[model samples]
Target: MNRYNLSKSTKTALFFLSLLPLQWGLMWWFNLHPDDLELYYSPFFEAISTLQLYSLAWLPFSIGDVFYLFLVIWLAVLIYRFIKFKRNRLNRFISFLGFCALFYTLFNVFWGFNYYRRPLNQQLQLSSDYSTEALVEFTCELIEVANASHLSIVENDTSAVNFNFSKSEMQNLVFEAYQEPSNFPNKLNYPTENIKSSLLSLPLSYAGFSGYLNPFTKEAQFNSLMPQYKWPTTMAHEVSHQLGFAKENEANFIAALVCINSKHKYLRYAGLTFALKYSLNDIYKRDPELFKVMLADVNEGIIKNYKTSRQFWEKYRGPSEVIMKQIYGNFLKANNQPKGIETYSYVTALLVNYHNTYQLF
Candidate 1:
C-alpha cells in the first residue's frame, strides 16, 4: 500500500474543491466578456429551448412539476441515508457536497449560464433612469389606458372579467405578439405552447409565487390559482424566461412588451395593468401625494379588479410564504441579481424609460 492512501471521501472532497477554481474562472471570464457571450451563446440557448420543446412539448402535463416532486423525494432519501449510514460525519458531509457540486455543474451547462449574458436593456439600448416627473407622467398615461381597457372588460357592474379564449388561443396570441418588428437582439424561434399551469398550484399559491421557469426541463410553469386576467401576463413572463431572459425584471419588461403589442384587448389590459402597478408603486415612493392623485384618476373598474386580486391572494398568506420568499431571495442574491427578489420592482424604471422613448402610451 502507498503511504498516501487517500480515502474515497478525501478524493471526493478534493475533486469538488478543485472545481471551485474552474467555476470562479468561468464567472470571471463571463462577467468580463458578456457582450462576446451575447454574440456566441444566443444560438446555444435557442438550441436548448428547441430541443426541450421537441422532447417535452408533446406531454399533456408539466414535466417540471413532476420533476419537482421527484427532487423533493430524492432529497429526503439522501438525508435519511446520510443519517442512517454508519459512516463518519465528515464522509457524509463530503457526499452531500459532491451532490451539490454535480447539480451546480449540470445547472450551468443546461441554462444557468444565461445569467452571465448581457442584459436585455443594453442590447435594446433602453435606458433605466428617469426623473420623478417622468415616472408620474408614465403612471398617468398607464392609468388612462388601464381605465379604458378595464371598461371594455367590465361592461356591466360586475368586477370579474370574462375569459372567452381557451388556453391555446391565449398561447397563440402571445406568440403573435413577438412576431412583429421588435427590439429583441436576435431572432428567436418563438416558443409555441411551451407554457403550462403548474401541477402544484395550491402550494405555489401559498408560496406567493405566480410562476417560474424550470431550467432543467425548459418549461414555463405558472400558478393556475390566479384570476384569468393574470393568466395571460404571467404566462408571457415565464415564456420570456424560456426565451432566455433569466433576470426577473428583464422577463417582466419583455412580457409587458409582448402583451401590450398584442391585438387582443385582454392581453393589452393585462400588460398595461402590469406596467401601471410598477410605475405607480415607484411614484408612490417618490411622492405619495402624487400617487394618491393618480390612483384617484384610475377608473372604478380597474380599482375593483385590483381589490379582487388583493383579496384573492390575502387568504393564502402564511409563514410558509415568508420562508419561501426568504429562500428564493437568497438564491437570487447568490446569482448575479444584487437586489434579489426586489429586482422585480426594477421593471418600473424600465417601463418609464420605454414609455418616454417610444411614446408607447
Candidate 2:
C-alpha cells in the first residue's frame, strides 16, 4: 500500500480531467472555430519543428530500438526478481505512460485553443467561400500539379539505383522515385500564421514529435530515427501536417505527392512507390482481376525495386518490433485516428480514386 501510495498515474489523470473542462471552456470562450474536421494538427506541429539541429539525419535505428526494448524489459524483469515478484514496478510503468497521456492532452488543448481563435487565413476563406465540391476540386488540382512535377508521376526510379529485387520490387521503385524532388525541399509553403516548438515524446520515447505551427515554434520538427530509405517521405509527411492536413491519411497522401515532385530521386520513389503498393493492395482486395491488370502495367525494373524493399525490411524484422507495432497501432486509434495505425497506409485510396476521375472538382 505504501509503494502504491500517491499513485502518480491517478494523480496525473485527475489533473488532466480537471483541466479538460477548463480547456473546453476556454476554447468556447475565445470563439476558436474548429476545422471542417475535429483535428487541426497544424498548430500543434508548428510548436515543435526545431529539428534543424539534426542535419544529415536519416538512420536505420530500428535495430537499436529493438535492443532498447529488450533493455527495458530486462530491467523490468530484474526488478521483479529482486522484489520477489511484487508488482510495484508495473505501477511505475503505468505512471510513465500516464504522464505521456497527460502531456498529449494538454498539448491538444493548446492546439485547440489556438485553432479556435486563429486569425482567419486564406484556407478559411477557401473553406467558406468555396463549396465542398469546389474545394475538393481545388485540392485535387493542387495534388495533380504536385504529382506532375515529378517524372515519377507514372514511374519509380528502377535503373538509377540498381538493386536486384525479389517479391517487393515495387516498394523499392517507390523509394527510388522520391529521390528526385526531395533533393530540394519544395519551394512552396502552405498557409501558416505562427510556428512554435514543443517537447512531445511518447511513453518511454517510443517516438518523438515536435509541434510545427502552434504557439510554440515556427518550422516543422523532423524525426531522423526512421530508416534512411523512409526519411524524405516522412519529412514531407510532417510538413503536410504542418500545412493543415490534419488527418494522418490526408497527410500521407499530400506528402507522397509533394515528395514525388521533389528534385531528389529518393523522394520521388518514396511517393510513387508507396502509393503504388497501397493501390495494388486495395485493388487486389476489391477485385483480384483488376489488381492483376494493374500489376501487368508495372515494368520488370519496378518489380525488382519492390522485391528489394521487402528483402531489406525482412532482414530487419524482430519480435520486439511486432509487439511495438501492435501497441502503436492502438495508440494511433486512441488519438482521434479511427483506423488506428492502418490509417497511415490508406493514402493509396485517395490516389487511386483521384486517377479514376479525369475531371477533378
Candidate 3:
C-alpha cells in the first residue's frame, strides 16, 4: 500500500479552514457564559490591548496604515498573477483564503470579541430605557453645554473656530483625558494609546467616515479633512473602540463621557455638540414641531458651526458617497449591529440614562 503525503500548502489551507470552526465554537461558548466573558474574557482582551499599545502605539506614523498599504499592493500582485500567470490557480486561491482567514482570526483575537461583552448600560448598572421627558431634558442640557463651549473657542477670520491642535497634540490630549475613571475605567485604561490622521484621509472623507480603529494594528485613524467641530469627538469615539467598546453606540457614549469630563473646553463643546445633534435629529424624526423648538434654543455660534460642517460635507455628497455609506452600513449589520449606521444615534438612550441618573450635566 502506498501512502500519499499532503503537500505543505494543502496543510496550511486546512489549518486556516479549521480555525473557522474553532472561532465559531469560541464565540458560542463565550455567548453562553456572558458574565464570565464580560468579567474575565473581555478584560483579558483589554490587557492584550495594553501590551499591543506599548509595542506599537508610539510610532510617529500609523503602523496599521503601512500594513494596509502593503496589503493592497499584495492583493494587486495576486490578481496580476492569477490573471497573467495563470498557473497554480488552486494554490493561489487557497493562499488568498488562508490570508483572509488569518486576518479575521487575528482581528477577533485582538479586538472583535468585545462585541459580545455586556452592553455599557448593564455594565454601569444604569437604566436602559428612558422616558421621552428625560430625552428632552438631556437634549436641553446638551444644548446649553454646546452653546457655552462654542462661545469659548477662538475663531478664525471666517468666523469658524480654528482647529489649532495638531493631530499629535490632540492624541496626547485624548490620552490625558481618558485618565479619569469617568472617562474610561481603570481596567480598560490605555494611557499611552494614540490616534493618527488616516493615510487614506482623502478617500475616507469622500466615503463619509470620520474615523475608524485598525483592529489588526490597534491604532485609531481619523479623517484629517473633517470639520474642526468634529475632530475631538471623532478621535474620542475611535479611542473608545480601542478601549474595547466594540459597538458603535457604546463607543459614542464613551466618547461623550470622555468629552464632558475633559478639562479642554473645545473637547467639552465637541462632545455635547455631537450628542445634541443626535438627540435633536432623533426628536425631529418623531416630532418636527419639537425639533424646530429645540433648534431655536441652540446658540448662534453653534448654528454657524453646524452650517460650516454641513457645507464641508455638502461638497462631498454624491452617488459614490451614498454607495460607500450603504456598503459600510451592511458591514456593520453583518457584525451584529442590527441598526447598522443608525446604531450611532442609539447612543442617545445611553446619554439620557446616564444624565437622568448621574446628573453629570
Per-candidate total of colliding backbone pairs: 0, 64, 0
Q: 218-337 in candidate 2: lDDT tens per residue? A: 234333333344545555665555444545666666666665564455556555665666656655665687667657655555566567656645654666457767875776564445
Clashes of 3: 0
TM-scores of the models, in the order given: 0.90, 0.52, 0.92
| C-alpha lDDT of candidate 3 relative to the true structure | 0.79
Predictions in order: lDDT: 0.78, 0.46, 0.79
Model 3 TM-score? 0.92
- What's the distance in Å from true for residue 231, model 1? 0.9
Residue-level lDDT tens digits of model 3 in 181-251: 66543334766867888998887878878899999878899988987778888888998898788898899
Q: Which is the winner by lDDT between candidate 1 and candidate 2?
A: 1
Higher-scoring candidate on lDDT, 2 or 3:
3
Off by over 4 Å in 1: 1-17, 88-92, 156-160, 182-188
In candidate 3, residue 265 scores what lDDT?
80
> What TM-score, to 2 decimals, does candidate 1 have?
0.90
Q: Would you list the rank order by lDDT, best first? A: 3, 1, 2
Candidate 2 lDDT score at position 56: 12
